[model samples]
Target: MDSEVRSYRTGGDEVVLDLTRDAADFVSGRGDGLLQVFVPHATAGIAVIETGAGSDDDLLAALGDLLPADDRWRHRHGSAGHGRSHVMPAIVPPHCTVPVLGGTLALGTWQSICLVDLNVDNAERQVRWSFLAA
Candidate 1:
Protein backbone atom coordinates (compact mmCIF):
# COMPACT_ATOMS: atom_id res chain seq x y z
CA MET A 1 0.00 0.00 0.00
CA ASP A 2 1.12 3.58 -0.71
CA SER A 3 0.55 6.61 1.47
CA GLU A 4 -0.58 9.97 0.14
CA VAL A 5 -0.01 13.07 2.24
CA ARG A 6 -1.79 16.43 2.26
CA SER A 7 0.89 18.44 4.03
CA TYR A 8 0.34 21.92 5.48
CA ARG A 9 3.20 23.77 7.05
CA THR A 10 3.03 26.14 9.98
CA GLY A 11 6.13 27.93 8.70
CA GLY A 12 9.34 27.03 6.87
CA ASP A 13 12.44 26.99 9.03
CA GLU A 14 13.64 23.43 8.96
CA VAL A 15 10.36 21.85 9.95
CA VAL A 16 10.94 18.18 10.62
CA LEU A 17 8.60 15.60 9.11
CA ASP A 18 9.58 12.40 10.83
CA LEU A 19 8.85 9.85 8.16
CA THR A 20 10.71 7.29 10.26
CA ARG A 21 7.59 6.33 12.15
CA ASP A 22 5.40 6.68 9.09
CA ALA A 23 7.75 4.62 6.96
CA ALA A 24 8.33 1.96 9.60
CA ASP A 25 4.64 1.69 10.28
CA PHE A 26 3.94 1.37 6.59
CA VAL A 27 6.71 -1.15 6.08
CA SER A 28 5.54 -3.24 8.98
CA GLY A 29 2.17 -3.55 7.35
CA ARG A 30 3.62 -4.75 4.06
CA GLY A 31 6.53 -6.57 2.51
CA ASP A 32 9.51 -4.25 2.18
CA GLY A 33 13.22 -4.35 1.46
CA LEU A 34 13.75 -0.75 0.47
CA LEU A 35 11.71 2.40 0.97
CA GLN A 36 11.44 5.10 -1.62
CA VAL A 37 10.35 8.59 -0.54
CA PHE A 38 9.43 10.84 -3.38
CA VAL A 39 8.12 14.42 -3.49
CA PRO A 40 6.87 15.31 -6.97
CA HIS A 41 7.28 19.06 -6.59
CA ALA A 42 10.00 21.04 -8.28
CA THR A 43 10.01 23.58 -5.46
CA ALA A 44 10.68 20.88 -2.90
CA GLY A 45 13.43 18.35 -2.35
CA ILE A 46 14.00 15.43 -0.03
CA ALA A 47 16.94 14.82 2.24
CA VAL A 48 18.14 13.01 5.35
CA ILE A 49 18.86 15.68 7.90
CA GLU A 50 19.18 15.93 11.64
CA THR A 51 15.86 16.82 13.19
CA GLY A 52 16.96 19.55 15.55
CA ALA A 53 16.28 23.22 15.98
CA GLY A 54 19.73 24.43 14.98
CA SER A 55 20.11 21.96 12.18
CA ASP A 56 16.83 22.95 10.63
CA ASP A 57 17.63 26.65 10.69
CA ASP A 58 21.08 26.06 9.33
CA LEU A 59 19.79 24.04 6.44
CA LEU A 60 17.23 26.63 5.42
CA ALA A 61 19.65 29.54 5.82
CA ALA A 62 22.27 27.75 3.79
CA LEU A 63 19.80 27.03 1.05
CA GLY A 64 18.71 30.66 0.94
CA ASP A 65 22.25 31.84 0.43
CA LEU A 66 22.99 29.12 -2.08
CA LEU A 67 20.01 30.12 -4.15
CA PRO A 68 18.94 33.64 -3.36
CA ALA A 69 15.27 34.02 -4.19
CA ASP A 70 15.59 37.77 -4.63
CA ASP A 71 18.35 37.56 -7.18
CA ARG A 72 17.72 38.85 -10.68
CA TRP A 73 16.88 35.37 -11.89
CA ARG A 74 15.34 35.30 -15.36
CA HIS A 75 12.96 32.52 -14.31
CA ARG A 76 11.06 34.93 -12.06
CA HIS A 77 9.50 36.71 -15.04
CA GLY A 78 6.04 35.14 -14.94
CA SER A 79 5.17 36.32 -11.36
CA ALA A 80 4.97 32.68 -10.26
CA GLY A 81 7.72 33.40 -7.70
CA HIS A 82 10.12 30.77 -6.34
CA GLY A 83 12.68 30.80 -9.07
CA ARG A 84 15.37 29.74 -6.63
CA SER A 85 13.08 27.10 -5.30
CA HIS A 86 13.10 25.53 -8.71
CA VAL A 87 16.87 25.63 -8.72
CA MET A 88 16.89 23.77 -5.38
CA PRO A 89 16.09 20.55 -7.20
CA ALA A 90 19.60 20.80 -8.59
CA ILE A 91 20.97 20.85 -5.03
CA VAL A 92 19.06 18.29 -3.00
CA PRO A 93 17.59 15.26 -4.68
CA PRO A 94 13.90 14.80 -5.46
CA HIS A 95 13.81 11.43 -3.66
CA CYS A 96 15.58 9.39 -1.07
CA THR A 97 16.40 5.65 -0.84
CA VAL A 98 16.72 4.01 2.54
CA PRO A 99 17.53 0.45 3.34
CA VAL A 100 14.89 -1.53 5.20
CA LEU A 101 16.31 -4.11 7.56
CA GLY A 102 14.35 -6.44 9.80
CA GLY A 103 11.16 -4.73 8.66
CA THR A 104 12.30 -1.32 9.89
CA LEU A 105 14.02 1.63 8.31
CA ALA A 106 17.77 1.74 8.90
CA LEU A 107 18.91 5.26 9.55
CA GLY A 108 21.72 6.89 11.43
CA THR A 109 21.23 8.08 14.99
CA TRP A 110 20.10 11.60 14.11
CA GLN A 111 19.00 11.09 10.54
CA SER A 112 15.37 11.71 9.64
CA ILE A 113 13.75 11.96 6.25
CA CYS A 114 12.40 15.43 5.49
CA LEU A 115 10.41 16.99 2.67
CA VAL A 116 11.69 20.53 2.17
CA ASP A 117 9.37 23.17 0.75
CA LEU A 118 11.14 26.27 -0.51
CA ASN A 119 8.12 28.26 -1.46
CA VAL A 120 7.49 31.76 -0.11
CA ASP A 121 4.03 31.32 1.32
CA ASN A 122 2.36 28.25 2.79
CA ALA A 123 0.57 25.99 0.36
CA GLU A 124 -0.76 22.49 0.46
CA ARG A 125 2.10 20.20 -0.58
CA GLN A 126 2.16 16.55 -1.54
CA VAL A 127 4.44 13.82 -0.31
CA ARG A 128 4.33 10.30 -1.68
CA TRP A 129 5.85 7.32 0.06
CA SER A 130 6.11 3.84 -1.39
CA PHE A 131 7.68 0.65 -0.11
CA LEU A 132 9.06 -1.92 -2.51
CA ALA A 133 10.90 -5.20 -2.34
CA ALA A 134 14.64 -4.81 -2.49
Candidate 2:
Protein backbone atom coordinates (compact mmCIF):
# COMPACT_ATOMS: atom_id res chain seq x y z
CA MET A 1 0.00 0.00 0.00
CA ASP A 2 1.19 3.50 -0.91
CA SER A 3 -0.40 6.85 -0.19
CA GLU A 4 0.04 10.62 -0.34
CA VAL A 5 -1.95 13.74 0.25
CA ARG A 6 -2.48 16.66 -2.13
CA SER A 7 -4.01 20.03 -1.40
CA TYR A 8 -6.17 22.29 -3.53
CA ARG A 9 -7.65 25.72 -3.04
CA THR A 10 -11.34 25.50 -3.75
CA GLY A 11 -11.82 29.19 -3.09
CA GLY A 12 -15.04 30.47 -1.53
CA ASP A 13 -17.49 28.91 -3.90
CA GLU A 14 -18.97 25.61 -4.90
CA VAL A 15 -16.81 23.80 -7.41
CA VAL A 16 -16.50 20.57 -9.35
CA LEU A 17 -12.80 20.07 -9.91
CA ASP A 18 -11.50 17.46 -12.30
CA LEU A 19 -8.78 15.28 -10.83
CA THR A 20 -8.54 12.57 -13.47
CA ARG A 21 -5.13 13.53 -14.88
CA ASP A 22 -3.52 13.69 -11.47
CA ALA A 23 -5.12 10.42 -10.43
CA ALA A 24 -3.86 8.76 -13.58
CA ASP A 25 -0.41 10.16 -13.03
CA PHE A 26 -0.28 8.81 -9.51
CA VAL A 27 -1.29 5.33 -10.60
CA SER A 28 1.01 5.35 -13.61
CA GLY A 29 3.45 2.44 -13.70
CA ARG A 30 2.13 1.16 -10.42
CA GLY A 31 0.66 -2.07 -11.88
CA ASP A 32 -2.70 -3.62 -11.11
CA GLY A 33 -4.27 -2.25 -7.97
CA LEU A 34 -7.00 -0.10 -6.51
CA LEU A 35 -6.85 3.67 -6.40
CA GLN A 36 -8.71 5.23 -3.54
CA VAL A 37 -9.44 8.95 -3.53
CA PHE A 38 -10.49 10.39 -0.23
CA VAL A 39 -11.21 13.96 0.76
CA PRO A 40 -10.56 14.75 4.40
CA HIS A 41 -13.26 17.35 4.89
CA ALA A 42 -16.71 17.39 6.32
CA THR A 43 -18.12 19.56 3.55
CA ALA A 44 -16.47 17.97 0.59
CA GLY A 45 -16.72 14.75 -1.40
CA ILE A 46 -15.30 12.80 -4.33
CA ALA A 47 -17.35 12.06 -7.41
CA VAL A 48 -16.89 9.98 -10.54
CA ILE A 49 -18.81 11.39 -13.47
CA GLU A 50 -18.60 12.73 -16.99
CA THR A 51 -17.03 16.17 -17.17
CA GLY A 52 -16.71 19.02 -19.71
CA ALA A 53 -20.15 18.05 -21.03
CA GLY A 54 -22.29 20.14 -18.67
CA SER A 55 -22.51 17.21 -16.27
CA ASP A 56 -20.40 19.00 -13.71
CA ASP A 57 -22.71 21.98 -13.69
CA ASP A 58 -25.65 19.67 -13.74
CA LEU A 59 -24.45 17.92 -10.63
CA LEU A 60 -24.05 21.19 -8.85
CA ALA A 61 -27.47 22.25 -9.98
CA ALA A 62 -29.03 19.06 -8.80
CA LEU A 63 -27.32 19.41 -5.46
CA GLY A 64 -28.55 22.97 -5.19
CA ASP A 65 -32.04 21.70 -5.71
CA LEU A 66 -31.66 18.90 -3.21
CA LEU A 67 -29.74 20.90 -0.61
CA PRO A 68 -30.60 24.53 -0.82
CA ALA A 69 -28.12 26.90 0.73
CA ASP A 70 -30.55 28.61 3.07
CA ASP A 71 -31.33 28.94 6.76
CA ARG A 72 -33.24 25.71 7.06
CA TRP A 73 -30.34 23.79 8.53
CA ARG A 74 -29.81 23.00 12.18
CA HIS A 75 -26.02 22.84 11.96
CA ARG A 76 -25.77 26.51 11.25
CA HIS A 77 -22.26 27.93 11.24
CA GLY A 78 -19.94 29.87 8.97
CA SER A 79 -21.72 30.90 5.79
CA ALA A 80 -25.44 30.63 5.19
CA GLY A 81 -26.80 27.16 4.73
CA HIS A 82 -23.40 25.79 5.64
CA GLY A 83 -25.19 22.90 7.26
CA ARG A 84 -26.13 21.73 3.82
CA SER A 85 -22.48 21.17 3.12
CA HIS A 86 -22.38 18.74 5.98
CA VAL A 87 -25.33 16.86 4.56
CA MET A 88 -23.75 16.73 1.13
CA PRO A 89 -21.41 13.96 2.15
CA ALA A 90 -24.38 11.71 2.79
CA ILE A 91 -25.38 12.13 -0.82
CA VAL A 92 -22.00 12.43 -2.54
CA PRO A 93 -19.75 10.55 -0.13
CA PRO A 94 -16.22 11.53 0.86
CA HIS A 95 -14.29 8.80 -0.96
CA CYS A 96 -14.28 6.80 -4.16
CA THR A 97 -12.32 3.78 -5.42
CA VAL A 98 -11.16 3.18 -8.94
CA PRO A 99 -9.53 0.15 -10.49
CA VAL A 100 -6.06 0.30 -11.98
CA LEU A 101 -5.11 -2.00 -14.83
CA GLY A 102 -1.41 -2.29 -15.64
CA GLY A 103 -0.75 1.03 -13.91
CA THR A 104 -3.51 2.82 -15.79
CA LEU A 105 -6.87 4.01 -14.53
CA ALA A 106 -9.67 1.73 -15.70
CA LEU A 107 -12.18 4.53 -16.16
CA GLY A 108 -14.98 4.57 -18.58
CA THR A 109 -14.60 6.58 -21.77
CA TRP A 110 -16.53 9.58 -20.45
CA GLN A 111 -15.96 9.13 -16.77
CA SER A 112 -13.77 11.47 -14.71
CA ILE A 113 -12.75 11.84 -11.09
CA CYS A 114 -13.89 15.11 -9.55
CA LEU A 115 -13.65 16.90 -6.26
CA VAL A 116 -17.00 18.30 -5.18
CA ASP A 117 -17.01 21.14 -2.71
CA LEU A 118 -20.11 22.87 -1.45
CA ASN A 119 -18.72 24.66 1.54
CA VAL A 120 -17.97 28.27 0.78
CA ASP A 121 -16.40 28.92 4.15
CA ASN A 122 -13.28 26.81 3.62
CA ALA A 123 -10.87 27.54 0.85
CA GLU A 124 -8.34 24.79 1.40
CA ARG A 125 -9.04 21.12 0.69
CA GLN A 126 -6.92 17.99 0.82
CA VAL A 127 -7.30 14.73 -1.02
CA ARG A 128 -5.57 11.54 0.07
CA TRP A 129 -4.59 9.11 -2.65
CA SER A 130 -3.90 5.53 -1.72
CA PHE A 131 -2.93 2.63 -3.94
CA LEU A 132 -3.18 -0.95 -2.87
CA ALA A 133 -1.57 -3.48 -5.14
CA ALA A 134 -3.60 -6.51 -6.04
Candidate 3:
Protein backbone atom coordinates (compact mmCIF):
# COMPACT_ATOMS: atom_id res chain seq x y z
CA MET A 1 0.00 0.00 0.00
CA ASP A 2 1.13 3.53 -0.77
CA SER A 3 -0.44 6.94 -0.16
CA GLU A 4 0.11 10.32 -1.75
CA VAL A 5 -1.34 13.81 -1.46
CA ARG A 6 -2.86 15.80 -4.29
CA SER A 7 -3.15 19.45 -3.54
CA TYR A 8 -5.80 21.41 -5.36
CA ARG A 9 -5.83 25.16 -5.72
CA THR A 10 -9.40 25.80 -6.83
CA GLY A 11 -12.95 25.06 -5.91
CA GLY A 12 -15.29 23.20 -8.25
CA ASP A 13 -12.35 21.80 -10.14
CA GLU A 14 -11.49 18.56 -11.94
CA VAL A 15 -8.06 17.06 -12.33
CA VAL A 16 -6.66 13.94 -13.98
CA LEU A 17 -4.97 11.67 -11.48
CA ASP A 18 -2.70 9.24 -13.21
CA LEU A 19 -2.44 5.97 -11.33
CA THR A 20 -0.21 3.96 -13.64
CA ARG A 21 1.45 2.01 -10.84
CA ASP A 22 -1.52 1.20 -8.61
CA ALA A 23 -1.24 -2.48 -9.39
CA ALA A 24 2.52 -2.71 -9.71
CA ASP A 25 3.16 -2.24 -5.98
CA PHE A 26 1.04 -5.21 -4.99
CA VAL A 27 4.14 -6.97 -3.58
CA SER A 28 4.10 -9.85 -6.03
CA GLY A 29 4.31 -7.89 -9.27
CA ARG A 30 2.04 -10.61 -10.69
CA GLY A 31 -1.30 -11.99 -9.53
CA ASP A 32 -5.06 -11.61 -9.42
CA GLY A 33 -5.87 -8.62 -7.23
CA LEU A 34 -7.93 -5.56 -6.43
CA LEU A 35 -6.68 -2.02 -6.78
CA GLN A 36 -8.35 0.17 -4.22
CA VAL A 37 -8.09 3.92 -4.60
CA PHE A 38 -9.39 5.98 -1.73
CA VAL A 39 -9.96 9.68 -1.29
CA PRO A 40 -9.87 10.34 2.41
CA HIS A 41 -11.89 13.50 2.53
CA ALA A 42 -15.45 14.69 2.86
CA THR A 43 -15.39 16.94 -0.15
CA ALA A 44 -13.50 14.96 -2.72
CA GLY A 45 -14.11 11.86 -4.86
CA ILE A 46 -12.33 9.43 -7.15
CA ALA A 47 -13.49 8.11 -10.51
CA VAL A 48 -12.26 6.13 -13.48
CA ILE A 49 -13.10 7.79 -16.77
CA GLU A 50 -11.91 8.55 -20.23
CA THR A 51 -9.33 11.36 -20.14
CA GLY A 52 -10.45 13.29 -23.17
CA ALA A 53 -13.33 14.51 -25.34
CA GLY A 54 -14.02 17.21 -22.77
CA SER A 55 -14.93 14.52 -20.27
CA ASP A 56 -13.26 16.41 -17.44
CA ASP A 57 -15.12 19.58 -18.27
CA ASP A 58 -18.37 17.69 -18.60
CA LEU A 59 -18.00 16.15 -15.16
CA LEU A 60 -17.11 19.46 -13.59
CA ALA A 61 -20.22 20.99 -15.07
CA ALA A 62 -22.33 18.07 -14.00
CA LEU A 63 -21.08 18.12 -10.41
CA GLY A 64 -21.66 21.84 -10.22
CA ASP A 65 -25.19 21.32 -11.42
CA LEU A 66 -25.77 18.53 -8.95
CA LEU A 67 -24.11 20.33 -6.05
CA PRO A 68 -23.91 23.96 -6.91
CA ALA A 69 -21.16 25.65 -4.95
CA ASP A 70 -23.15 28.87 -4.60
CA ASP A 71 -25.70 27.14 -2.41
CA ARG A 72 -25.46 27.72 1.34
CA TRP A 73 -24.89 24.47 3.18
CA ARG A 74 -24.73 23.94 6.94
CA HIS A 75 -21.06 23.17 6.59
CA ARG A 76 -20.81 26.79 5.55
CA HIS A 77 -21.02 27.36 9.32
CA GLY A 78 -17.31 26.89 9.12
CA SER A 79 -14.88 28.91 7.01
CA ALA A 80 -15.70 26.86 3.92
CA GLY A 81 -18.48 28.41 1.87
CA HIS A 82 -19.77 25.29 0.20
CA GLY A 83 -21.32 22.18 1.71
CA ARG A 84 -22.58 20.32 -1.31
CA SER A 85 -19.07 19.14 -1.95
CA HIS A 86 -19.32 17.07 1.18
CA VAL A 87 -22.79 15.94 0.20
CA MET A 88 -21.55 14.79 -3.15
CA PRO A 89 -18.81 12.67 -1.66
CA ALA A 90 -21.29 10.82 0.48
CA ILE A 91 -22.99 9.50 -2.64
CA VAL A 92 -19.86 8.96 -4.69
CA PRO A 93 -17.72 5.94 -3.98
CA PRO A 94 -14.40 7.14 -2.67
CA HIS A 95 -12.82 3.76 -2.99
CA CYS A 96 -12.33 2.20 -6.45
CA THR A 97 -10.93 -1.29 -6.91
CA VAL A 98 -9.92 -2.78 -10.24
CA PRO A 99 -8.89 -6.26 -11.23
CA VAL A 100 -5.18 -6.68 -11.76
CA LEU A 101 -3.47 -9.03 -14.20
CA GLY A 102 0.23 -9.42 -14.81
CA GLY A 103 0.71 -6.70 -12.15
CA THR A 104 -1.02 -3.96 -14.07
CA LEU A 105 -4.30 -2.13 -13.65
CA ALA A 106 -6.34 -3.72 -16.44
CA LEU A 107 -8.42 -0.75 -17.44
CA GLY A 108 -9.61 0.14 -20.90
CA THR A 109 -7.07 1.61 -23.26
CA TRP A 110 -8.49 5.15 -22.82
CA GLN A 111 -9.67 4.87 -19.27
CA SER A 112 -7.94 6.99 -16.62
CA ILE A 113 -8.05 7.58 -12.90
CA CYS A 114 -9.27 10.98 -11.75
CA LEU A 115 -9.89 12.98 -8.60
CA VAL A 116 -12.65 15.52 -8.26
CA ASP A 117 -12.00 18.20 -5.67
CA LEU A 118 -15.15 20.06 -4.69
CA ASN A 119 -13.86 22.18 -1.85
CA VAL A 120 -13.11 25.87 -1.92
CA ASP A 121 -9.61 25.72 -0.54
CA ASN A 122 -6.08 25.26 -1.71
CA ALA A 123 -4.83 22.36 0.36
CA GLU A 124 -3.44 18.86 0.37
CA ARG A 125 -5.66 15.82 -0.33
CA GLN A 126 -4.77 12.35 0.84
CA VAL A 127 -5.28 9.62 -1.78
CA ARG A 128 -4.81 6.15 -0.36
CA TRP A 129 -3.76 3.56 -2.88
CA SER A 130 -3.90 -0.11 -1.95
CA PHE A 131 -3.73 -3.44 -3.70
CA LEU A 132 -4.84 -6.92 -2.66
CA ALA A 133 -2.92 -9.40 -4.76
CA ALA A 134 -4.02 -12.96 -4.98
User: In order, what lDDT does every prediction score?
Assistant: 0.71, 0.97, 0.66
TM-scores for every predicted model: 0.81, 0.99, 0.77
How high is the lDDT of residue 117 in model 1?
Answer: 72
Q: Arrange candidates by TM-score, highest first: which order? A: 2, 1, 3
How well is each residue in 89-132 modelled by candidate 3, as lDDT tens digits?
A: 76556777778777777888877777777665635577776766
Give the local distance difference test score of model 3.
Answer: 0.66
lDDT of 2 by residue, 1-134 (tens): 89999999999889999999999999999999999999999999999999999999999999999999999999998999999999999999999999999999999999999999999999999999999999
The alpha-carbon lDDT assigned to residue 44 of candidate 3 equals 77
TM-score of 1: 0.81
Backbone clashes for every candidate come to 0, 0, 0
Give the range where candidate 2 is weakest over 10 consecutive residues by summed lDDT: 7-16
- List the lowest-lDDT window of 10 residues for candidate 3: 5-14
Residue 123 Cα positional deviation in candidate 2, in Å, after optimal superposition: 0.7
Between candidates 1 and 3, the one scoring higher on lDDT is 1
As for TM-score, the candidate ahead, 1 or 2, is 2
**lDDT comparing candidate 1 with the true structure:** 0.71
